[model samples]
Target: MTKRIAAGAPPGLHRALSIVEETAEGSKLWCAAAAVMACTGGRRGRAAAAAGLASVATAQLISNGVCKQLVKRRRPPKEWIPHDEVEDRPDSSSFPSGHTAAALAFTVAITPTWPLAGALCALPAAVVAVERVQSGAHYPSDVTAGAAIGLTGAWLTRHAPRLILRHWL
Candidate 1:
């Protein structure tokens, strides 16, 4: 399965992933921005934080619990994967990437309030995607699926209250 995916990827994707991972200024910006959003008391800011956190949590639950067990794919052995600067080697199955999912979820949740937040999330998300490759944990498609799940989760969280209200009232 890994061989099949690797064969189809565009050229130099690994290099692109490395470039994305090496940049940290963007992530710092996100952390500071997320802090500001948490503290601002603005309705939009609060909503971003709430939706972002909730979406990420929900996405994680679905991916790690349901999808992983269902897919049951193995990660590339440490021997075959390249060395990288990422902080940790994830223990989970590699079919859907959790980091990429969370980063995309953050973007989805925060973009409405802070445009930069979404772009900034992309930096780390890109890193996570690359790290998966570098760490030999996932194929590009798996990371892509994880990101889609997160984005969908974020979108759902943002609109859920209104949907519920309409249904209930």
Candidate 2:
């Protein structure tokens, strides 16, 4: 099902999607959020960066450490993907997508403080989510679960500081 869905994509779009997928690797999306925040300068900049980074970390833990550990599902087989796109895939269990999780985490966490930046990130985040499935790195359900974790992590990061401060005051 997933293989067919991915294979049906327009031939012209494959290269663009592959490029987006590659550029989103590792901490690039999260770091981009941080750089945007920092460029704004002052305390707001620092707070946004801190929140985005913290949320991404939490989401990564939930997606990779918790959900992936519990699910233990294999990625769509390499043969199911385009020959050119399979080489860079990860060896980890594929359930919730860590890439989408981090993309959403940074996007969501930054929204409260920097709405414009959040808006800009929405495109890349969406692309990353789609690419995870298209690249055979995740299933649709895996991407959905990852998005949930990202939102939860962003909520926690945004509110936890206030929750802690209440204990002191």
TM-score of each: 0.71, 0.89
Off by over 4 Å in 1: 1-33, 40-43, 77-79, 84-88
**Superposed Cα deviation of residue 3, candidate 2 (Å):** 2.0
lDDT of 1 at 74: 68
Model 1: lDDT equals 0.66
Best by lDDT: 2
- What lDDT does the true structure give each of the candidates? 0.66, 0.84
10 residues in a row with least lDDT, candidate 1? 21-30
Off by over 4 Å in 2: 167-169
Determine the C-alpha RMSD for candidate 2 after optimal superposition of all C-alphas.
1.9
**Tens-digit lDDT string for candidate 1 (22-113):** 44223443344466777874777776776667777777777777888888776765545434422345566777876667667777788877
Clash count of each predicted structure: 0, 0
Cα displacement (angstroms), candidate 2, residue 99, comes to 0.5
lDDT of 2 by residue, 98-145 (tens): 988898999999888878878888898998998888878888888888
